[model samples]
Target: MPNPKIFDLTPPDLSDYIAYPILIVSHDAGGASVLAAWVERHLDVGQCDFLLEGPALRYFSGLKIEDSQRHSRTSLVPSEVSRFACVITSTSGEDVSLEREYIQQCRLLAVKVLSMLDHWVNYVPRFCIDGRLCWPDLLMVNDVYAQQLLVAIPGAPPSLLFDNYYLQQQVAQVLQYRKSSALESTQILSRRILYVSEPSTDSRYNEFELLERFLNSIFNYDYFNTQQLQVRVRLHPREKLGKYDELMFHTFSEYSINYCKNELYHSLAWSNTVVGAQTTPMVIALYAGIEVYSCLPEVVEKMTLPFDKIRRIY
Candidate 1:
C-alpha cells in the first residue's frame, strides 16, 4: 500500500478555528497543556471540540469546555468524529495500540488525522505497530531533528513534517501571562526550587531512589539547610498525591507537594531552578532562562528526549 499524502498547510487565522473546528486529543497533562495553550491562542471559548482522555481531563478541567463539545475518548463514536474537519493529537506510546485502531478507523471514514510530537524521544515507538508505521496525514514537530527522523520511516511523506509554531507561541504567551500574575503575589522565597516529578509507573527508573537522590542533592547543597533555600515538588498528573505526601512527610516534611494549584508556567516563573528527569516543562524552563538539572540516573536511556539536542535550539 502507498503512504498517505501529507500536507504542510499554513495555519489560518483564529477566525478559521471558530468557523471550522477541530478535534484535539492527548494522553498526558503536559501534552494537553501544550494543546490547550494553542487552542487558547487560536480558538475562541466553546468554539472547538476535544476527545480528551488520560491526564488530559485533569489538565483541562479548569478550562471552560462545553459538555457537548468535550468528550472522553470512549464516548466519541465514529459518526461523531466523521464530522470533524480534522483530528489533531499528541502522539502517545502507551495508547498507540488503541491509537492504531483509531487511526485505521479514521482512515476508513475518510477523516484526516494529524499527530503532534510531544517530545523527541520515542520518535518511532509512538506510531509504529508490528514494525510497520501508522502514518498520519500531517505531523507537527518543533525542530528539524524530528522532521528528519519522521521522514526516514519507510513510506513516510516528508511533506507532512511541519513546525509546531503553536508550542513556541505558547511559551511566549504563557510567560507574559505569568509575569503579570507574579507581580500580584506576596509569597516570597529566597531560592525557589521547582521539582517536576514524573510517575515511576514503568520500572526503568526507581521512583523512590530518584526522589531520594533529588532530596539528597538539595539537602546536601551548601545553602539548603539555611533559610535561603525552599523547595516545592510538583507531581505529574499520573502521580498520586498520597505517595509523595508519605515520602516527603516522613523524609522531609518541610517540602510542599502541590497538585492542581501548581500551574507549570507560574511555577517556572517562580522557580530559580527547574529539576526533572525528561519532561516538556524542563525544556520550557530552559527556554525561560531558568537553570535545569536532570535527576534521572543513567539506566533510563531512551525514555526521554535528549536534553543535549534540545539545548542546542536555545
Candidate 2:
C-alpha cells in the first residue's frame, strides 16, 4: 500500500502576510482562476492582486473574476505591484523555477506567497521533497508530482484522503443532487468541449495535435453518451512579449486550451462532458464523477484501473 499523504500548517498569522495586500501569483493555464475563485470564496477580506508575466496578462485577465464574486470591501491590487510580483514570481518560459535566494529575499520583504496547490512549492525552494513525497510548506502533496492538496491543515482539522476543501465542498454540493428523484428534476446537460490547442516548442510531444486528433476521432463515436453534448472550440488568449503566457503556443490545449462550461478542475467547474486528450481536466472530471471519454484508448486502459482504486490506494 502507498503511504498516507502528508499535510502542512502554513504560518497563517505571520507579520509577513499582515495588513499589507497579498499578491497571489498564479502561472499555469487556469491556475490563476482557481486561486482567485478560492480567495473569493474563503478569504474575501484579503486585499489581493493577480500578478502576470507580460504574455500571460491578456489570458488571465480575460478570465478574471467578476465583480459579483467580489465582496463589498476587497480592494483591487495595483498594477505596478502586480507586474513586479509577477516578474519576481515568474522563473522562465519553459518552467516556473523560483530562485531560493530570490524567494527568501521576497520573504524578507514580507511578500506573501500566493500560488496554485500544484505550483505552490515551486515558489519556495526550501520545502522538503523525498522521491514519492514532497512537502510544500505545510501542504501535504501525495507525490513529487504535487497534483493534489489536503482539505484541512495538518493538526488543525481532520481531512479525507483528498484535501482540497473547495473540491470537497463542491463535491458535497453536486452530490446532494445525486438521488434518483433529484436526478429526474435536474436537466444535466453535458456540453461537448473542444480543448482547442497547439504544441509548445519545449514539450516532447505536441499535446495540442495529439489532443485534437483525439477529439476528432472519438467525439462522434457511440462509445460515449452524447445526450447532453454541445461541442465547441477552445479560443486561445491574447499574448504580449517578454512574459510567459500560460497560453504560449509552443503547444496549445494544455498550454492555452479554451475551457468552456464542459471543462472541470481549472476554474468554473463544467457541467458538460470532456472531449479531448490526456490532461488536468481529465483528472478533475473523474473526481467530479462526470462522464469522460478518451480518444486515447491505451491511456484509458492504463489509467482507469488506478482511478477506480484511488480511494483504496490511499
TM-score of each: 0.72, 0.46
lDDT of 1 by residue, 1-314 (tens): 11334324453332322234677766666556656655565556465677777776775676688888877657886456677776767766654354555555566677776666656666566767667666766665666566556656777533333445445754675568657877325335466778788765467676777777777666666534555666778777677776666567777766553432456677777777777777777877777666777777766554355456332110
Show how many residue pairs clash in every candidate, following the order shown. Answer: 0, 15
Question: Measured by TM-score, how close is model 2 to the native structure?
Answer: 0.46
lDDT of 2 by residue, 1-314 (tens): 23235335332432333233444444444343344344455443234444444333433453444453232112433323422332122222234422222334344444433234423222233222222222222222223334232332232222112244444544555445444234424436444443433234323345544554554443434334553444444433322231223333333333223334232332213334554334444445556676654444343333322244122100
lDDT value for model 1: 0.63
Q: Pick the TM-score winner.
A: 1
Model 2 misplaced regions, further than 4 Å:
5-21, 41-104, 107-114, 119-202, 219-230, 235-272, 294-314
Per-candidate Cα lDDT values, in order, are 0.63, 0.37
